[model samples]
Target: MINRILVVCTGNICRSPTAAHLLREALLGCDIAIGSAGLGALIGQPIDGAALATLECHGHRPQLHRARQLTAELAQEADLILTMEQGQVQGVIQRIPEVRGKIFLLGKWQGELEIPDPYRQGPEAFEHSYGLIERAVASWAGRLLLRR
Candidate 1:
């Protein structure tokens, strides 16, 4: 049973938070916990407006998503750490080696694609990023929610 999972990205304001919401909704009946963080977060800021709006369109609005910094302590506690890209996963692995097998790109195991950061990009970029995360998290939930 995967008790906890952490979704990570360059900033918690966008990708990770969106991924966390989808996974949480998909695995609502399970006992697992889902969370997200940023490698270079601006702690306490709300998610960027466009990204939040996109997620809202998908029926998810995270209530209290204060940006969180990536810490070894948090990484060590997670059962699985899913990132948006392989490079980001590598960064986490270097910082918290204990998270080894558990640290992986959210799109890696399945699509082998990278969810590009839509930070400074326009709505189209955010929309594309949202699609990537939604599919990956949905697949993750399916596997994680299986009854043991």
Candidate 2:
């Protein structure tokens, strides 16, 4: 019954978008909708160039991803919300208290490791973060696909 997933991070440009697209690719042909947002987004801005490059390296086609701010409405719409960091889970819950049980760390299934933000850091940082996101997505995708 998990129809929609929302990935969250500090800025929509980096971790969240990368995770979102990867999740979408992982769940290919499934009836689930995936999206991402930021707690304090550079609204309407395109995904970070480093992030786009990292995704391309991993075989995911880059898209014109525009940053969007996280809102209560988006939280309400998502069947499950995944955040790049533990702190982000609290941020989302604070904004939408009703989404308590539905929000989780993207790495929850992998020992709860937090995916670091690579915004403006450099290619190395982006690459490191991308590795973490990839693993997290794989873990979640496995569980999701099994239930379907």
Candidate 3:
């Protein structure tokens, strides 16, 4: 019955967007709508170039997306919210207590750690981060699908 999902990261320019793309592709059978946002967001920016390249390598062609501020309304609307780090989960919950149960780390379910922001780090960092996003999203989607 989960009909909408929101992925979160620091800037929304890299990690979250990549995770959204992977989830959309892998969970194609689901009725859920997937999206991403940032906590300390650079609102209205497109996905980073290196992130685009990394997704392309993975056979994912993501559509246009602009970063948006995290709001209580948004958090309340989503059926689930996935964040890159523990701090973001706390931030979202503090702002919108209703999202408590649905909030989780994109990394933890995949048996790893946080997906660090690679902004300004260089292509190598973007590549590494994208790999982490892909793996986490795939793992999450698989578990979600099974539950359905």
Candidate 4:
């Protein structure tokens, strides 16, 4: 059974954290641990304001989220690793080949959709990204619930 999940993107401040929080909510009360990191993280940074606002608008109270860089140790710890984009999958596997079997696109169930980054792109971009992430998270949650 998958117990640990890691959501990943280029920067932790946007896509990854958003997905992670949504996933955490979706998997609430389950024996699953969800977290996020970035390939090129803005370490110590908080979630992008627009992303935060979008999440709040959607009723997800994301806690004190701080950006973190993806590390081999973190990758190895996750039973499943979800990436926002295809390139991120390659980037993670290329850096940590041992995790190749566990890494997948966050949108794997949504026609292999990729969640785009909305950094500095304003509210519309963040909203669009949030919608995609929400759908992807729902898809994964259903599959994961079945596994449980």
| CA lDDT, every model vs. true structure | 0.86, 0.92, 0.87, 0.93
Question: Residue 143 lDDT in model 1?
Answer: 72
Better of 2 and 4 by lDDT: 4
Cand. 2 TM to true fold: 0.97
The TM-score leader among the candidates is 4
Question: For candidate 4, lDDT tens digit of each residue in 39-146?
Answer: 999999999888999999988789899999999999999999999899999999899999999999999999999888899898999999999999999999999999
Query: What digit string (tens of lDDT, one per residue) describes model 3 on residues 1-148?
Result: 7889999888888899889988999899888899888888889999988888888877778999898888887888898899998999998888888889999899977664788888888888988988888888778888889878
TM-score of each: 0.94, 0.97, 0.94, 0.98
Cα deviation of 20, candidate 3, in Å: 0.5
Query: Which residue pairs come into collision in candidate 4?
Result: none
Clashing pairs in 2: none
- State candidate 3's TM-score: 0.94
**Model 3, stretches more than 4 Å misplaced?**
none
What C-alpha RMSD separates each model from the true structure? Answer: 1.2, 0.8, 1.3, 0.6
Give the CA lDDT, 0 to 100, for residue 142 in model 2. Answer: 95
Q: Model 1 Cα displacement at 96 (Å)? A: 0.9
Off by over 4 Å in 2: none
Candidate 2 or 1, higher TM-score: 2
For residues 13-119, what per-residue lDDT tens digits would candidate 1 score against the true structure?
99998888888888877877888899998799888888899988877767678899999988888988999988898899888887898987788656688999999
